[model samples]
Target: MDKNTIIGILLIGAVIIGFSIYNQPSEEQIKAQQELLAKQEADKKKAVEQQKAAQKKQEEIKKQTLEDTTALFHQALTGSAENIVLKNDKLELTINSKGGTVTKAVIKDYKSLDGAKDVTLFDEKDQSLSFKIDGKEQNINTEELFFSASEKTDSTVTLTATAGAGKTLTMRYLLGKDYMLHFSLQAQGMEGVFSSKTNAVNVEWNERCRQQEKGFTFENRYATLTYKEKDGGTDYLSETSEKIDERISETLDWIAFKNQFFSAMMIAKNDFAPNASLTSIPQQKESGYLKEYKARVETFFDPTGKTPTELEFFFGPNDFRLLQAMEKESKFGKDLKMERLVYLGWPLFRIINRWFTLYVFDWLTNLGLNMGIVLILITLLLKAITYPLVKKSYMSSAKMRVLKPKLDEATKQYDKPEDQMQKQQAMMQMYAQYGVSPLSGCLPMVIQMPIWIAMFNFVPNAIQLRGESFLWIEDLSTYDPIAEWGTNIWMIGDHLSLTCILFCGANLLYSWMTMRQQRDQMVGAQAQQMKMMQWMMFLMPLMFFFIFNDYSAGLNFYYFVSLFFSAAIMWALRKTTNDEKLLKALEARYQENKNNPKKVGGLAARLEAMQKQQQEMQRKREELERKRKGV
Candidate 1:
């Protein structure tokens, strides 16, 4: 029985085994599946190999491009550099073959700051002018390459260079009798050498301005980078900031490196490219360098290399007259307006200096008078011009002096804060009745301040007075040091200037005279305040002595003469004016004002309105206070 059961179970198990085996995949199908998997693996391997081949080809192209660029750069830099010199009546320039740029510029008529030798604005190591050309196959900098010089002359020179692949660049320079040097840059036969899409060439100009003045701090204060936009006005970087980095998106007309009394300018006859940049970094205090200036500009360039650009270089003193004449005589049909480099205050003060002070100074110098004498005469002339204003101011002060007793009586009624508004109204009424304006004296003084400030700016920057000598002073443009301690102090330098001391003395005397007159006119608290301010005025001269000790001797001398003239004129005014007559006139005017009861206008009307507003506010404040106190 066990055999029969086992056989049946075995038969069922065999049938199940056979069915499972039949349902499984055949060998041909398995082989086909395996072949498909293998084909996919082969396709992925082929794709990876193709990708690697593409990357290798790209790397080879990059390497070839780098080698081509290096070869081109080497070709451009193969020649030896040479230098050519050109001289004119005012300037001497050395042109370098490397970049066909000015390597050195010397002023023939000027001496160094120490009076040891001729002044050199820049040297080979301190300046560079370079061009960057972006071509289809190569990019190169001209500054690192060399050029061949040809057609050399005493006042002109031409340089030619190759940019590989039938491209040529030429730079020509011509020096005139004046401070101007004409420069031209031309590109020839560069059809496929540069990128045809862009129409601009990049230029870089850098200069380290050496100190050529007696005062480095003063010179550095004036050292700045100035630029004029094409069809726009002139602008400048901040001179007082530590570093300046500016970008101009508009076209530029010119760029300049302006020192205190001199400048080096580059003028573009056409216009620069639409984008440019300028940077400046001040050197160390004792580095003998005023500033480091850099300009990155773009100029119009044709890929066809047909047209050329004309430019100009001006290396000279910052003489206002010369610059003005140059502006008038410009051949580019644009006013360069280089005279703006002169630091003679803003427009109003500059107009005064240009129209009055400089003309007078020139006239006086033409008379063969020494600069000191010219300064004195100019001071006297200016005093005469302002004598009317001074007299009016003094007369106003005297009239107020005559009315002081009445003003004091009025002020006594304003002893408490509650009476402040009423007291102010009463004082204003009295002033209106007497026709005495408290600001009249100050107004006249304010009108004369611009002239004084203009002169102060003009004298220090006047190149005409640079080497002019006067009594006890060898150079008027620098401090006349009577003694030098060889140590720097706060505000005061190591040297003591005689002209500065004299200026301080004159200022002190003028201050004393003015203070005495003002003090005699005031009483009580005002007199006390005047006395304190008189001491402060005396201290002002001492403070100025320290400040001016290192300043220009011509400026100090001019100030001294101006102060002396002011004191003398004031003394004469006091002697000629009769106080009793002034008092009587003031009383008569007051009586007439009371009788006529004239309608107030101008400042009096404004003051009355303000007083009314203030009195109303005070009344409201008192009413509120009473309500709060329930009184």
Candidate 2:
């Protein structure tokens, strides 16, 4: 071997030795690494232990919950419920031992649309009442528990639910001789059982309003939840809205689940607490249900089982007189005003029906008149009451018709667009001089509109005509379907109503005749406008046919007969009266009152003032334009 190669090998060995010494870990570093490895192993072991402990704790909690739930409510968890019935002259109630509530309500005096069966207000599945008992272990509802029913008395029954060790909840029902069902609840030895701080129980009533009438669309429009606040006016949730949730922030006295002609109402003997929630959810029309109504109210109970929370139920036909005679049966000791459920109309129309139409119809019916004859008599009575105004209206229109030649001559004098206000003013002046107000014809009709609308409202809700048949009509209180199909149609239902068609025809004929009387009296743009209105008026009846196709047969019949007779009367007057005599009388009166200031003091004066103001402004604008043009 060469000496250089040997030296290179020694140097390489030395370099390797030095690098090993420089990169080697110290004793402290090795000790730290050992400690870190031991810590990681300990942490892994701790995590495993914690996971096992948490799982065991969760299992213990679940087991405790199950045991607690089984302790107080074990016997009530499963059982067959008993039904006890209480009947009266007007109502029949079935109370179930499951929830100790009325499971079924039947109005005994009314029949269903099927005609043979009685009207069942609600069945077991349609309605359920539950009482809530908050437990320290588990929240509980009494609707799931089985109750022990006591033997029935003449008018009362008591249902009791025993929790254990003498803890009991009792519900008692006393049937009134009429449509009211009295209910009360009391608790015994439930100090530690009920976790309620206020010692009040929640009373939840859920009800699905089923179709009661033959016309589901029409009847469903009237089915809703109506309530009255304590010391306040009556109110209702939207009948048309699909879903509505309302928390009555104030206390309530009564809540009514009102169908078209029937109602199931609950009245609080004291007052239901604030925050009572009223919910309305619309069900499918084909489901044979109209709406699902729910009311959640809190009422206090006596923990010692002495004083009971009292409530009353009203289940019957919504007969206005009968309901008006019901007891002042609520919290504020005010009249129940249960008659409001039989909705007549809004304020003015309602007043007319309540005061006049109702009494007259009752009197006529009591006198053994048929319902159709009664409606005819009502129409005749109203016409007779306003005969003088009708005569005056016709005479005013005749006066305008007779003076058409002179008004046309005046129109010829002012034929430009700029002369419109002047022409209108001149026409008004002529009307004043002739003692013929253009509004004279309309004023009487306007005054009589309330009575007309009152009858419109009165006939549909007139329960006296429910089953009364006249000619081809089977039921006056529902649509008289002359033709029916199996499937439903949009905007038009499954059937066509005969009375509704007749009513539309009468309306169209009457409108055409009335327009022909006045159409010739207008000229120029006014004539064009009247011609447009004639078409609109003709279409109004067609639109009404769609809107009122499902209205009560009695209402349509009344309108048809009323409008037909009105047209006949107008035609008779047209034939029997002499236009020459009316013109002569107007001419004589014009001569006598042409200068009388008193004759022009009221509406005519105000109209003249407005026209003059408008004319004066028009003149100013014209003068300004002329100056701007340097003319």
- Tell me the tens digit of each residue's lDDT in model 1 across 176-219: 77888888777787676677675777889999988888767666
Off by over 4 Å in 1: 1-76, 163-166, 328-330, 406-430, 532-535, 599-613
Residue 143 deviation, candidate 2, in Å? 0.6
Report the C-alpha lDDT of model 2 over 1-631, residue by residue, as the tens digit: 3465579879999999999998898999999999999999999899889999966874565456447654665566557988888997778888888877888988886778767558898999899888875566555577767888886875799887777777777888888778878788887886676554646778899999988888887788778799888877788888888554588998888899888888899888777889998999877878998999999888766555667788888888878888876754333366667788888888999999999898888899899998989988998888888778887787777778888877888777787878888888888777777766677767556857888788877776777887888989988888999899998898788999999999999999988988987875675667766865676789989999999899889989999988888888778877877978877887887777765756654455567677889899988999999999999
lDDT of 1: 0.80
Deviation of model 1 at 218, angstroms: 1.6
Error of 1 at 611 (Å): 4.0
Best by lDDT: 2
TM-scores for the candidates: 0.82, 0.85
Clashing pairs in 1: none
